[model samples]
Target: MNTKQKVKYKKNSKKKMNWITDHLFLFPTILFFLIFILYPILYNIMLSFKKMDVSNFMTGGVWAGLANYQAIFSDPLLYKALLNSFIFTFACIVIEFIIGFALALLFRQKFPGVNFMRGLILVVWMLPSVVVGVLYKWIMAGDSGVLNFVLTQVGLIEENILWVSSEQFALIAVTAANIWHGIPFYMIILLGGLSTLPRDLYEAAKIDGANGWKSFLKITLPLMKPTVLVLLMLGLINSFKVFDLIYVMTGGGPLDATTVIPYYAYKLSFLQFNFGEGGAVSGIMLILVIILAIVYLKLMQKEEAN
Candidate 1:
C-alpha cells in the first residue's frame, strides 16, 4: 500500500481499537453492578409484590398484591417508626447544618490551630459510624458516663441520668451523638464551598456600606445557594438511612422510641423473618428517595435556568 493509504488504514484501526477497548473496559463494572446491586434491587422488588416469610419459605410464597403496603400503613408500629425517622432526620439536618456552618465560617479566617482543628474534626468523620455508636454507648453508660460526671461536677445535675434507658430521652441522646459525628462531614463540604467564594464580592459589599449580616444575606447566601441545596438534600438522605448508630446505641429500645425506618426494615427482615414486609418497606423507601432526588434536581434545574 502507498504511505498515505497505510497511514489512513492505521488511523482507522486505532479508532476501532479505541472503541473496542472502551466497551471492553466497561464489562466488569457492568457485570458486578448488575450482579451485586441491580439484581438484588430487582429481586427485592419482586419479593415486595409477593408474600414470603419463615412460614412459607420452602413451600413457595404467596402473592399479596398491595396487602403488604396496606399493612405497612395500617400498622401502628410502622407509623411510630416513620415518625421517629422524620424526627431523627430533622434533628440531624438542623444540628449538623448549624455546627458545620459555624465551623466553616470560623475556619475561613486564618489561625494557628485552624488546620489542626480541621484535621481533628475529620477524624470523627473518618471513624466507622458503628464504632462511633459503640463508643458513645459506653460513654453514656448510666453509672460512669463522662457526660454525667462532667455535668455533676459543674452542678448541672445531682445524679447520673439514664440517657439510653429512658424512652423519653433515648432518641434524643442517640441523635445528639449522631450530630456530633456528622457535623464534620457537613463542615468539610461547606468549607470547600466557602473557600471557592469570591472575596471581591465581600470587599465590594463592605465598600458599598454593607455590614457583616447584610453582606452575608445579600451576597454570601445567594452565592452559596447551590452548595447549600446540595448539602441539604444529601444530609436529608443520609439521616434517613441511619441504622448502625441507633441499632448499636438504643437497639430501638425503651418502647421503640429510636426505631427509624431502616432499623424497622432490618428488624422485619432478620428478627421477625418477614422478608416480604421488609422488602416492601425497602421498596417504598427507595421510591421515596428517588422521588425526592428527582424533585431536587428539577428545582436545581429551574434555579439554574433563572
Candidate 2:
C-alpha cells in the first residue's frame, strides 16, 4: 500500500483499539452483575409464580398461578409486618432529618475538635451494618444493657424495661437502633449539601432582619429541598429493607411485632421453606420501591418546571 493508504489504515486501527480498551474494563463488572443480580431477580420473578417448597426440590417447581400472592394477602402476619415497616420507616426518617440537619449545621461551624468529631462520625458510617446491629443488640439487652443501666442510674425508672420484648416497644426499639446507625450517613450527605449552599443567602437574610429560625425556615429549607427529598427517598428505602438489626435483636419476636417486610421474606424463604411466598414478597417490595421512585421523579420534574 502507498504511504497515505498506510496512514489511513493506522488511524482506523487506532480508533478501533481505543474503543476496545475503553469498554474492556466494563466487561467483568457487567458480566458479574448480570450473573449475580439480574439472573437472581429474574429467577425470583419466576419463582413468585411457581409452587416451590421443600418437597419438590428434585422435581421442577410447579406452577402455582396466583396462589402465592393470594396466600400473602390472606396472611394476618403480612399486615402486621407491613404496618411495622411503615411505622419504623416514618419515625426513623423524621428523626434522622431533624438530628442530621442539626448535626450538619453544627459541623458547618468552626469549633474545637470539629474535625475529629466529623472523622469519628464518618467512622461510624464506615462500620459494617452487621457490626452496628450486633452492638445495638448488646446495648438493648434487658439485664445488662447500657441503656437500662443509664436510665436506672438517673432514676428514670424503678427497673430495667424490656426494650425489645413487647409488641408496644419492639417497633420503636428497632427504629431507634436504625436511627443511631443511620444518622451519620444523613449528617455526611446533608453536610455536603450545606457546603454547596451559598453563604450569601444567609448573609442577605440576616441583613433583611430575618432571625436565625426564620432564615432557616424560609431560605435554608427551600434551598435544601432537593437534597432533603433525595435523602428522604433513600432513607425510606433503606429503612424499609432493614433486616440485620431486627433479626439480630428481636428475630421478629414479641408476637411478630418487629417483623418488617424483609425479615418476613427471610422467614418465609429460609425458616418456612416457602420460596414462592418469599419471592412474591420480594416482587411486591420491588414494585413499591419503583412506585416511590416514579413519584419522586414526577415531583422533582414539577418543581423544576415551576
TM-score of each: 0.94, 0.93
Write candidate 2's Cα lDDT for 1-306 as tens digits.
999999999999999999999889889999999999999989888999998989995685899988999999999989988988899899999998889999999999998999999999888878777788788878877889998999999999888888878777777778888898889989998999999989898999899999999988998888888898899889989888988888888899889989989998999999999989999999888888999999999988987887
Best by lDDT: 1
Report the number of clashing residue pairs per model. 0, 0
Q: What is the lDDT of residue 179 in candidate 2?
A: 91
> Candidate 1 lDDT, tens digit per residue, 1-306?
999999999999999999999989999999999999999999889888788998897876899998788878788988899899899999999999989998999989998998998899899999988999989888887898888889999999998899998888899889998998899989999999999999999999899999999988898788888999999999999999999999999999888989989998999889999888899899988998999899899979987998
lDDT of each: 0.91, 0.89
**TM-score result, candidate 2:** 0.93
